[model samples]
Target: MLATLLGLDHLVIAVRDLDAAAAEWRALGFTVSPRGLHSPHIGSANHTMMFGEDYLELLGVVAPQPHNEALRAFLSAREGLERAAFTTTDAAAGVAALRARGLAATGPVDFSRPVPLPDGGGAEARFTVFHFPREEAPAGLRVFACQHHTRDAVWVPTLQSHPNGVTRILSALVATEDPAGAAAHLARLIEGTARRDGAFHRVATGPGRADIAFAPRAAIAALARCAEEALPLEGGAGMVLPTRKPRPPALASGTAIIFEEAA
Candidate 1:
């Protein structure tokens, strides 16, 4: 059986300073886990936050060796939630399918990370990640994914407490320059039902769903125009995620997850 495409695994933000960002998330209530450094085969060094089975990672550059041009470019863009990632069961097959759809991708490459086990020991799990190559003006918000080896561990977060009300990831907003083309490309790459409505495309999967929103990066300025509220951060981007009940911020990372009580 082909590895099933699971829901979102995690989201990563490429920040300017790992220490500062991790500190911000901790003050907000998340038990930001220990930070880790990844090498060549793995990629950049990262500080992580766990939220049940899902997580949010803050990645930054330490050295420029083995240099990844893409990662370097993202860092140059200066601070913000950088990448949105989905989880899959099989990396190899997933990449193949994506290619068949005409989207250029990389990896299914062997990816591994060590997690601190509850028993005080650490265990390493292997996985794969497939990513869109360039962060072009047209594909800045391009989609990517991860597939992990399931050996059963005591890390991650409890699904019940996920902050996003994400009943199954209704969809995500991907702002890209070529909304129409990106939507069409995604429609073919993801083996799911999709419908386009102007600049937004809704993608539906068996147990998960997501919306890809296309817009130029310049549009972030509009978001800044919103009224400012007293958020946890002294001065940073913030928003509330409404849920069925009032709960503390589910998890914290560079981009903290906010929860709201259902109205």
Candidate 2:
């Protein structure tokens, strides 16, 4: 009983200053959403960049607490891609499936936050999240399954358009100490298989069929066009974006986002 992959939900980049991070992304031609605060208990806030079905979340601590201590520690160390979230239609069932596969999983925790509507009204965007055990993930990255209760509240059409001409996230690159082992773990989690591509291990999924590449730490630097000294040894190293035209990759919040011409 392997867990099914329902495609990517959203990727999170944790930052110290939310406004500054949002501005940085805006300068890079992304249409960042207005800042939204999480529930008081969660003590976090975010600005989202919606890209049709998939999105990117720039998250920051609004008020720190014991619950968010891990997030705080991540921000304290550095700002970058911290989490890779996959979409799941039924988070509780997803958790159960993973547990049956002998994988450690926690939560189908329900949470919601108010989102402002275009007509000056507001709606609560609800979610049930299934979290993977930290030990199972490659270092510096957290993987989880997210089930959205109010999809309309988050994927507003106006937020999908970007000035940079980016249409979709084509792939994500993960740098790991053991690429083969990590790739195998990902394959099992997604209930899909992995294949070797040079020194990289690749997994493909969803309607868009985006690729997830697991590569050695040294190889990731070269692929991202960043110096080895600057890139983190583990976690999300880069993303492949299919754009209307060719554009240079941008390094934001310590992640390399490469842009490619759409077919």
Model 2 Cα shift for residue 110 (angstroms): 1.0
Give lDDT tens digits, candidate 2, residues 166-195. 877878888887888877778776777788
Q: List the candidates' TM-scores in order.
A: 0.69, 0.93
The Cα local distance difference test for each model comes to 0.52, 0.81
lDDT tens digits by residue: candidate 1, 1-263:
11456655655667778898878766654456666666565566776655444565678777675435556776674565565666777677777876775767787666566666555777665666777554422245445677766435324443124333422222334444555675555555555555766444445433532334443323322333322221112112222334564555433333334454555
lDDT of 1: 0.52
Candidate 2 local distance difference test against the native: 0.81
Best prediction by lDDT:
2
RMSD of 1: 5.8
Please give the RMSD to the true structure for each candidate, in Å: 5.8, 1.9
As a TM-score, model 2 comes out at 0.93
